[model samples]
Target: MLTLLAQTGSAGADSQSLAFFNFITTHWQFCLLHFLEFAIWGAWIVVLGNLLNARGFTRKEIGSIYACMPIGTMISILILGPLADKYFSTQVMIGVLHLVGAVLLILMARTDNARRFYWLTLLYALAFSPTLGLVNAIVFKHDADIFGGLANQGFPWIRVFGTIGWIAAGLSHTLILKKGQPVNANPLLLAAGLSLVLGLYAFTLPADPSKVALAAADAVAGEPAVAAVADVGILQGSIEMLSRHPIFFLVTFVGAMAMGLYFAFGALFLEKTGVPPRTVGPVMTIGQWIEIFFMLALPWFLGKDNVNMNWVLLVGICAWAVRFGVFAIGKPLPMVLFGVAIHGICFDFFFAAGMVNANLIAPESLTATAQSVYGFLVYGLGMYLGSELSGWLNQYFTKPTTAADGTPDTVTNWRAFWAIPGVCVAICAGLFFMSTLGRPPAGDGSNAPAEIPAQASEVGE
Candidate 1:
């Protein structure tokens, strides 16, 4: 009887293993698409500011340059996203934009002047921002077709490959360029090469039908072609929710600023604090590597039985404070790395979970509008403000000085610089914690399991 039960279990395991193997074999193209998509970003963004500093640009200049990406993203949502929804096939648009972006990246690598670099980076951002959304759209379009009811589960498996691609890019950048070499444009050049490859490869991807065709079909059936321009009601409702939920608004806004500060300076901070220049990319990637595990475990934390989103978000916000606090202390490398290792918690708990909370706070009819409001507030307005503020702080903490050998240079009070954001995030987390002490978890105040957005789980730098 025992042997019979053991054989049954063994057979089940074997069947599951075979099923997974088949799944991978069938979906390899989508996996590769997700991989190259992020590889293009991870290659250069981590170390771009550091490279600019090595070339003598000021912190303010670096901050301004970093701000462009968010600006471009905001613009794309207004223009490119709508246009893609109405006109172009997803894959064709992706291929053309990336191909154009590759040329812009190459130009950005060759240009040394900060202003010229700024303009080129903005242009590259405009060309690249649409692809992020487009990639997800195409993947979902196909995922629904392939997996039907299980598309959500299937997505994470393929998307994990993008994180791996990011990790690979970081390690590869370190490997290709040594610490002793001039911190030249090698990172951008590497990104350009990858972008070129992905551009050509995109053209060959499975063609998802254009959204325009669907809209046209609906029109022919005497349905509304568009919703007719008034999100006014939805917009008004979203604003009212934000006003009513000040804790939610404040916490999300502060957390986003913390994210902005990290993206702007985290790589440069590591390099400044005795991490080798070449190894900065890899060290920065430690967070992303940790991100994979935390993101996977997120559903468990946010399970229906848990019902403690306030606690989860507080912990995430506090993790950022800890991350910056350690960077300010800037001591034993292991502790610093520990701080970096917790980024998954910081991102997944705060930002990813916050998306669900946003969905819950708004009425069901206004779900999409609520998300758009949250994205605009956090990724758009919040990130832009935070980037600019971080740059200003960098400038404030930096001063011109002379080295021991008499070379003129600038030195930043790194401890002071890191402390500001750390303290700010800490204060926000504390306030949020205190506010939530007696309240129900963020949601509609019911026991329904929050429908977590698949896109929210996606890892980003």
Candidate 2:
């Protein structure tokens, strides 16, 4: 279906048909690039906690390991985004990042020490963080229209293959990699191998460098306009833009708080509710699959004439609250599994919708920075705080009720731990409702009455 979509165009549209064919033929390498890129992360990420526990790593350290993701994301926002935009091709940068991450994974495989593991993982995360944005930039540059439906269609199709790669990795671990119990090495090896493949393949993709327009502007001026512009302190300009919109900051804070709470206990909730370790991977994968579906449908849904962004976001928050509530109540496994599907609306509506909202409000030149800011809030500040809180809560709520050997006398007080996030969600939802008392701006690409700059335009060429 994707191949057909990539090859065909409207009737009598010979030029567009040829362009579509050329796009597919030329960029076919991206399919493999993305496949391996995500395969590496997926191989172990969902199961890392189990692996750490098996190794007898402290629960606190395990939580800290999860914190690596957001911490890396935060660092990338501050340093990598600007550097990539200024100095490197997005494809090459991503390739290098993955290669470095692969090395770290290999090193992690060789280590039995927990501290060494944590330090190496953090390094790997730092190298890996910037690539997320770089890859998206590369894809969007090829198909510039943010609102163009075809661009949305192509990327998700490529990404879905990544999920397939993840499922393959999961099954490999379950069947071949581990004799019986879940082990760390299998997923790490799978991730490392795929990372190397992605790194090598990336060099072959179309070279997409930073500052195309600025470079063009420089060439016309014949005196390095980019250098002069950089010298004038662009950081200050971006910072000023952010300061003018206090509401964006508040939104970011709220998002971070909610996300932190979610990540801290989300998986633990399931584990306590009687879901087995083997089933966790499949259940989480179901959520990713659902998210891909929502991403495919998002442009259509948001583009509808009377769609309210706040309402969409509210629905997502409600889904999130219900998802946790279901887990808290310890429903049957199938019902709990069905609730995982809410991830599509919960994640997409919050993150993707927030990204689009930011795009609608930021200055054209600051689009990358604005996106980076959002990433910083969600992954960096939000997840870091959340992870720590989760670790503490996990220890606090889950008492050691049995000896090392299996025993029937064990008991767990799960309700209080689960309810903390529930209350947080309800409060955040209420705050959001109050903040957007008036309906969200229609999907006409108009900014709300908020003090957004006039220079920001939709990059959907």
Candidate 3:
């Protein structure tokens, strides 16, 4: 009997191991999707301004081009969010959108006409922004119930690989691709290819649309006499639940504001620093590597016993301050590179942590809407404000000098340009510190009332 029991136990362990292996194998496609999605952006986003400049576009034009992303994201939140919830499978929508983006990317590669480039890029941005949220929805739909909470945990790990893909694309542009040119088509083509691959791969993800149908069916069965009433109740309940959480709304606003400044200033700072266009890829790679390491350790650092969300956010704010401070000081390339490394803390803590906090505060019925709202704020309105402001600032602080051939050369007052972001980070830090102090919520994962009120909450709290 003892021998039989031992044999049974061994078999059970083998079954458990196989189940875990199968889980990862089945879901591996989602990781690949994320990798390629980010790889597309990584190839061009950090260096697109330089490309435009090389092609005779002005600094203001480049800022306007970059600002398209946020604008597209904002527009999609109103249109795409409801459509994804009602009509299409999230994966199908993502696949279609990315495939369209791929074609637009190819079009971008073929164009030197600035006006054509601007419109095409706007199309690409609109298609791409919705996919970020859709991909997450698809991933969460497949995660096991026992491991549902692990969605945020494991998702970041997979997403970090996307950054790795980004770094690889960046390095490739610097080394094998650009051939030392200020602007090259290779990176854009590479991004296009990866996007196509992701579009094709997205079709293979585990089915998610069925759940929406199943919920509708269940609702019909439960209230056949009043099906319309039941539908209204679900919608009303979701809105009411979201409305009750003021902190969630406030944090979303803060997230938008911080991200706006970060994205806008990040591109402008690199351009002002006189970093050669080809070299910016590797410099960005250094920052991405730091981001990867920080993300890998985040679960441990922010887990139950370690740092609370407030402390993590505070450190992130400080890191942003330090990063821009280094830039403001007019440091050498190496020091500037080191400061860029703080991207790990700045992004992972502020943005990624904000996602986690959103997850914590959102009720199950409103989960998708809540997360989508956060994206809308950060990528849409926040980015819009950041890009416009940064452009104005760049125009104000940098004087135009004439090149030897009579073309204009833009010379930035690096100290003043960099100091602006440093001050922004300082203000973010102050707001966060005060919010944390006012309402000290139980930091131990209990769903106690959040310590901070919504209107005053910092970006990720």
Candidate 4:
């Protein structure tokens, strides 16, 4: 009997091992999909502002450059989201758009003229923004078939590769460029190469024609705009949620606008603060590295009932003030690093937690739409407005000057520049905190809005 039992146990173990091996072999493409998707983005975005600064573009021009992606995201939400859902294969659209974007990226790298680069970047943004949603759609549509009962586990593992890919992209700049090498177009070229590879690889993935994830903004898609616009009902429901949670609405809009200040100028800020060009890419990635840890720990912070939502979100919004305040101070490199590192908290705590709260607050029928609405407000309109204001402010603070080496140059009162957003966010935080004081905690039955059914109280929990 002992011998028979031993043999049976060995057989079961062997079967399990074989299944695990098959899982890895079949799902490797999805992992690569996410890795290359983010790698291509991280390769250039972290350093683009600094490069533009070096190229003699004004801070305002750079802000406009940054705005292109947000504009593209808004268009994709309204147009590409529906197109990918109804007419085209998700994989095919991703493959084609990325392939086109790769070409545009090459053009962008070649341009020395700011005007030309602006147009090229706008075109590239349109080509690239929709792919963010399409990639998520592919995973959501196929995870069930690929991982079966383990689909939940499979998604995060595959998604984590995106974070790794972003890290790799940043580290590559550190490795390839020597210290003090001037910022150049090389990052753009590297991104183009990766996009080419990703475009080709996307073709091999399974064909999917399903709808794009309305909650695309809920994920770390890129530079803050993770949403695509959806049904009118979703937009209406999102507006209602904002109306009901007046505090949430105000904090989210203002916080995202403040986030724009960083996205538009953080790289340039690092450069001005004495960070070497080669190391800046890796340094900017500090937040993303920290984000991985915070994201994993978020469930703990959120608690089982997510009763901590208000505090979590409030802290997240508050981090923006902290980061901007640190940047405004701009001394003691460690202090600056701390500000950079907390980007994870800013994103995971505020944005990610906010998405969860949105789902909880919305009725089941409006859940997906609610996600879309929140995304549109935060990343779409809010980010765009912020970008525009940041540009105008940077331009206002800048004055033309001659470099110490007797070359023509410009200087910005960066301290003053950063302080504006810092003060604005601080005010927003104070207002948000005050608003939450008398309100019921998130997930409580009393917290549910009149439009939400009673059972939503359980859902919130």
Best by the lDDT measure:
1
Tens-digit lDDT string for candidate 1 (1-461): 99999999999999978977787788888889889989999999889888999888889888888888788767766667667756777788889998998899889888889999989988998998878767766766665455664565667777778888888999986677876664678888889999999999999998864565444332221111022113546557667777877888887888787777788888888777778888888888888888888777786787784487778888888988999999899988888888788889888888988887776766766666666666766776677777888899999999999999999988889899989889999999889888888788755765645545654643355
Candidate rank order under lDDT? 1, 4, 3, 2
Question: For residues 282-387, could you state the per-residue lDDT of candidate 4 as single tens digits?
Answer: 9988888898887767767877567777788889888988998898899988999899999888888887777777767766666666666666766677778888
Give the whole-model CA lDDT for all candidates, comma-separated: 0.78, 0.62, 0.64, 0.75
lDDT of 1: 0.78
**TM-score of model 1 (CA atoms):** 0.91
> Which candidate leads in TM-score?
1
Stretches of candidate 1 off by over 4 Å are 1-18, 210-234, 443-451, 457-459
Q: Which residue runs does candidate 3 get wrong by more than 4 Å?
A: 1-26, 144-153, 176-179, 204-209, 213-258, 261-268, 271-274, 303-307, 359-373, 404-407, 442-461
Cα displacement (Å) at residue 103, model 3: 1.8
Per-candidate TM-score against the hidden true structure = 0.91, 0.78, 0.78, 0.86
Which residue pairs in candidate 2 collide? 146-460
Q: Give the Cα error of residue 149 in candidate 2, in Å.
A: 14
The positional error of residue 356 in candidate 1, measured at the CA in angstroms, is: 1.6
Better of 1 and 4 by lDDT: 1
